[model samples]
Target: MTIPGGELFDNRDGEGRLRVGVLISGSGTNLQALIDACERHEINATVAVVVSNKHDAFGLERARKAGIPAVFVDRTAYTTISAYNHAIAEALDDHAVELVVMAGYMRLLGQEVLHAFPGRVMNLHPALLPAFPGASGIKEAFDYGAKVTGVTVHFADEHFDRGPVIAQEVVRIAEDDTVATLEAKIHAVEHGLIVEAVGLFADGRLEIDGRKVRVLPER
Candidate 1:
């Protein structure tokens, strides 16, 4: 099943909620946040599954605790990067996932996987992207002594954190702030920013034009 280019996402799950698959590589605090939002009816979606590239990822435990399917896809199991991406996409497709969310999955997916989902992959970044675009965002921002930093949620293309932004929330950097303090603030905003972005997607309210994403008025 391949999504055609220029197609907007439609939440076609019969359950009346978008079927979402979350990808993670660590503790999955953001995954927990998504789970909480879904349980509280804060979003019109359900996490169909949680997949981790790391077998020891705590996010798998989080998924199991929530009675959700948890899977581990080891990168080394595949000989090629494209093959690995295809494997992950295959799992999401198996669950009939309508929305694919990268909640800290460390690997970059190639066109093989992105083509499967098309414009439906979502990602949350720990910083205001176009500024801090790598793994250690909080530390980089703090070490550089930036005044304001925040969270960004966006569509995921092949590029790393360079997709059209969906939402961003600013966090004021205090005069005497440590990396830990900045990280806490960034995560707090990430938990909500990602939920809001996914909520917009679940409602089929996002339109992507070139590199810009316009969130349409909620129906």
Candidate 2:
């Protein structure tokens, strides 16, 4: 997909690292993975800020411990979803965020935020998408008795888990594996795959063409 102005958008900071704003609603294991990746220089990016709809979310604590700005935008305070999303966009804008990572963020983002950072939002799903696309992906896949399920990192559109796929890694289910074991395997894959996808975005290697994402050669 072409960018808004038909030009590749580069929003890197002076340090040449992408400014990332991560949105989370839970414990933030994936967010921690990203923080670790940035700390180890595995990715050319930094966690500029973290936003959460719930004030009690542990992800906020994770961000605080990492010294990144953690913002709590209470959904109940806003009268409309648009107002809430605009508030979220405002928070990201305050940090000059170039990429938006939805790491277990429960609410769907509206156009107010999407228009602000077109083609720059990413999300992680527990199951390889086009199969189980919602919050119960792990349980759904396990109940369906699928032999293999995996993680998917993809660009986020207005719809739920229906954007361009960027990266995916399969995890085979062992006969003796319980749902808890399957979930553990999926989470493991999610941590690495999300980091890899973020790294690709930071390196300017991901190009969107229609509904598909292409990874360019390493620079």
Candidate 3:
């Protein structure tokens, strides 16, 4: 996996928090975790907005309930992927998004958004990336009978689930663990690891080095 070249300024919210835009396509469990972290002051950030490609995504509701602006740019409304992604980028920029987090966002973002945010875009994948990638990651890991699996947070590059890894936590596969159980464990780990990874990014604690992302010691 190649690391995209670029860097972001250390911008802060009015109170020194990071302003983030979360993109999602489903129930938004990870989105909820980030919101909870914000509310608890665990992460030095606030969600500026939440963008969903699916109009009916529960993430939009989650955002509204948290008093965060929620926008849905229906992918079907655009003829091309770049056009759709441009609208998403506009939505994020319009809200002054400093970081873009793919909580459960299913679509691979096009170059429009990738260029718009550069190193500021992050994605959470279900398996230890550079391993099982794509939508069927969890299933693939299970079928492969791996003893251990995990989640990864990485910068979003041009390819799918291929980027410099920011953070990861392992989940040991129990002998009795069914796919459902393994999935639950993976998600549980994701809830925490993703939050930690985003917090690190917001704090300027991450640096890209080829295929490696070094998380710097907190100052």
Candidate 4:
């Protein structure tokens, strides 16, 4: 299968698998979710590598424990954002990464990285986006006194959480819900939605039409 731009869609060998590369900054709960799905064969994708912008990120430990190749490409060591993003793209290519997933990855990706991977990059945001975006979305939602919040899995674009949403799972914000409680709910939805969206992408069940996403039934 192929898209209009000559991009391969649903192209796989006889094994019917997709290779994934995960980027992380802190705890790798979503990465763990993907790993679990792959282990159980619940998704047709495999985590090929885990990359981190922080050297001491706990996600690195998680990846190592899972016997996956973990790399530290510290952004602080680079002089500019573009330099760091270039290095990241190189690392992903070195690992032959097919799809790039940002899970708890705190850094804002540069245009270089976005263009390098194009439609192959995905990200999990802790809020139903176009609402609360950025680093502290959960806290922002709680402070704003929103009655509902959720997680969004979207294709990564140059802008912050403004990409085309692939999937979303809503979580009700109770009247008594504090920042911590809201964050917990956000995390739960993030983990589940990310895995589900990745599964759809792996199975060639996702299509992007302008700013909208179309999910097709599995063949």
Candidate 5:
């Protein structure tokens, strides 16, 4: 995975909160978690906007209810992936987004957005990444008879689910647990771990050194 190389200035808003743009594709349970965290002041940030490629995504409704701007950039309207991604980047930039979080977004970000945000992009995966990647991670882990699977929050790179891991929490698979149960367990962990990664980034505690990430002490 190639890291998008560029320096990004601190784009905190006047209230000293990081401005976040979250991209989602589905129900956006994770998006809700981030919104809740911001509301509760668990993180020093605010969700400025939510972007979705699918117009009917429930995440858009979630964003609307939160009073955050919800944008649907129709992929069908663009001929090339780069064009679609560029539109997404434009939307984030319009909101003064400091951090881009791919909560449940289905598409891989292109260079247009990557170059714009660089190390400021993050993603949450269902299984311990570099392991079961892709849309069906929870099912793959269950079918593989893995005893322990977990959630991973990492910096987004060019490839899918391949980037510097920021944090992970393990979920033990029980003998009685089915794929559905395992998925539930994974999502529960995801909600917390993703928020933790975002909080670390918001506080300037994450330092990416090659494939490694160092979580610095709080000031």
Candidate 6:
């Protein structure tokens, strides 16, 4: 649970707002949420960059439309996962990112990216983690007949969806709900929770200790 050399960034002086680099691999719903929050000034951070593993990801187009710097780091071009992650880390660093948010980023990040960002990287998972950790989380919950499922926003560790929990929002699964229905509800919660968590982070209201997250009172 211990993140190596975890030092929280200081935003008290307001020299500049937190700069966030978002990574996505799909439709980018959550990416859109963050961008909207930044535009509305609901969060004190800006989307400094957006990187995608796939060149044709719709998220890249979203970023470009927002006028944010977007990069495509293809994993197939790299010989190893570590190399690809190193390139991702370099891209984030190049933008002077203070935080990295993974929204529908399918690839499991390597140790290089984890070490490079330390406690700075965050990810949103469809299911309440430690329950369904891998892909197709909504389908997993539906197959298992779970009555209630939720969304989890957590730090990005070397493992998949195994990082410390930051925030979570629960959603009820009705008996009539199919996988798609459940996924839709999950996405709704994911968008709102991610925006809220990013605002808390930008305001320096989040304190991480081990696997626990403390939301301090706003200043």
Model 4 per-residue lDDT tens digits across residues 32-118:
999998889998888889999888889999899989999999778899889989999988878777789999998788887788887
The deviation in Å at residue 79 for candidate 2 is 0.6
TM-score of each: 0.93, 0.95, 0.94, 0.92, 0.95, 0.92
How much lDDT does candidate 4 score?
A: 0.84
Pairs with backbone N, CA or C atoms under 3 Å apart (clashes), candidate 6: none
lDDT (Cα, tens digit) per residue for candidate 3, span 25-127: 9999999999999999998789999999899999999999999999999878999888999999999999888889999899999899989987889999999
lDDT of 5 by residue, 1-219 (tens): 232222233567766888899999999999999999999999888999999999999999999999999999999999999999999999999999988999989988898998998888999999998999999999999999999999999988899999899998999999999998998898999999988988888777788889898888776
Worst 10 residues of 6 by lDDT: 4-13
The superposed Cα distance between candidate 3 and the true structure at residue 14, in angstroms, equals 1.7
User: Which RMSD does model 5 reach against the true structure?
Assistant: 2.9
Candidate 3 segments whose C-alpha is farther than 4 A from its true place: 1-11
lDDT of 2: 0.89
- Error of model 1, residue 172, in angstroms: 0.9
Count of backbone collisions in candidate 5:
0
The better candidate by lDDT, 1 or 4, is 1
TM-score of 2: 0.95
C-alpha lDDT of residue 156 in model 1: 91
Q: Provide the lDDT at 139 for model 4.
A: 88
Q: Model 5: which ten-residue window has the lowest total lDDT?
A: 1-10
Which lDDT tens digits does candidate 6 get at residues 1-219? 332221245532244677889999998999999999888888778899999999999999999999999899988899988889999999998988888899999999888887888788999999988888888888998899888889999988888899889898888899889888888899999999999988888777777887798887767
